[model samples]
Target: MKVTTTLIAAALACGASFAEAQAVQYAGGKTTFDGKCVVCHQAGGKGMDGLAPPLVEYPGKYAGTDEGRRHLGHTVLYGMFGPIKVKDKSYNFKMPSFASMSDAEIAEVLNYVVFDLNAQHGSAKPFDAEQIKALRASPVDGSAVHAQRESVVKSLGL
Candidate 1:
């Protein structure tokens, strides 16, 4: 009976640990990423070759600035097409929009990419739902987002 009780306690402890981990700061964003982004961005945001750009570096850099931050929101909501360069490599693909998702969800997913996946630790604030809502008011197609990339890149000096 004691052995069985100890095993149960161990299981309970592990369960609690898992729950705590899930409740971390970026948990909401991580959940959104796992569902929507992992397929393309892949695990740990490493991205795919000749396809999606690895998000690990740029996202962190983007979160630091206003234009870049806005670009992040636009990219997710509008998606992007055509060729883009990241880490000196070229990626040409069509990213699908997630416009149907709520503003809060988009913000959460961006936060996941910028802070959690990219590990951007600094004064850059977590994106708010209202900011995303504001961006949502002006909806554009993926091409527009792609076109806007040059300006944003210039602003970020990337």
Candidate 2:
């Protein structure tokens, strides 16, 4: 009985620790976004008027789909270039890759963008490091990533 009780206590403690870690990570993600992505995406994720496309809407909506989720990971990992339209506006800019960041950091930043900034509570499951890892395993360039985006947008009929 004592052994069982000890095991239960240990499990609970571990659970609590995990929760706390996640909270910290979420905050860190926001910080990372502010420090790294804000230059072009802006404070509230509103990209430059015509220079950089706003990251406000599409990111969350993209997270809602399977391919879109992959796209998000790929975009961050490989970077994106060329012209793309968002909110009925055209943006022809190059988004440099952030492949240097760890998978966890990438996941956290996207989570911040999808949940905090966009408030996309109804979006698909939050991205995990494993997903980022898988995408990173098969590398692609920014232009190809942009081409994939076209397909994703078309499939969503957006």
Candidate 3:
């Protein structure tokens, strides 16, 4: 009984530590997001009315699949434009490209969106710099990214 109790306690402690470490990873992402993403996405990523789509829902869904994950990276690297719908709401704004940002920075920002804003802990996977870098090589325009998003959304079975 004592051994079992000790094991449980250790597991809890480890979990707490892992959570703390995970939070640390978001710090850089949060800073980058605040400086660049906050004006459109708002403080909590609730998004603006008739303007930007909320980051809270789709990002978690996007993190679930390989294509979805690739779409996330392409969105940042290429910047999506034209009309797009989120949660039955139509938004037709042009999101500018952030291709100048390094791979690590982009990954961190996406990590912020996927994990912190979306509250997708344990349900979605975190992004790494390598993933974004891989998408960087094959450059495409914002229109392509938007098209990719369309296909990815459908592929998600939504």
Best by lDDT: 2
- Checking candidate 1 for backbone clashes, the offending pairs are none
Candidate 3 Cα errors over 4 Å, as ranges: 1-25, 121-123
- Cα lDDT of candidate 3 equals 0.86
- For every candidate structure, what is the RMSD over all alpha carbons to the true structure, in angstroms? 3.7, 10.3, 7.8
Off by over 4 Å in 2: 1-25
Alpha-carbon deviation at 154 in model 2, angstroms? 1.1
lDDT of 3 by residue, 1-158 (tens): 99999999999999998996577558899889999988997886888877888898888889888888888898888889888888789888778899999999999999989888876644577899888888988899999889989998898766
Task: Give the per-residue lDDT of model 2 (tens digit) for 86-132.
Answer: 86899998999999999999999998888777755464678889999
- Candidates in order have lDDT scores of 0.86, 0.87, 0.86
lDDT of 1 at 72: 90
Residue 63 lDDT, candidate 1, scale 0-100: 79
Let me know the TM-score candidate 3 reaches against the reference structure. 0.81
TM-score of each: 0.83, 0.81, 0.81
Between candidates 1 and 2, the one scoring higher on TM-score is 1
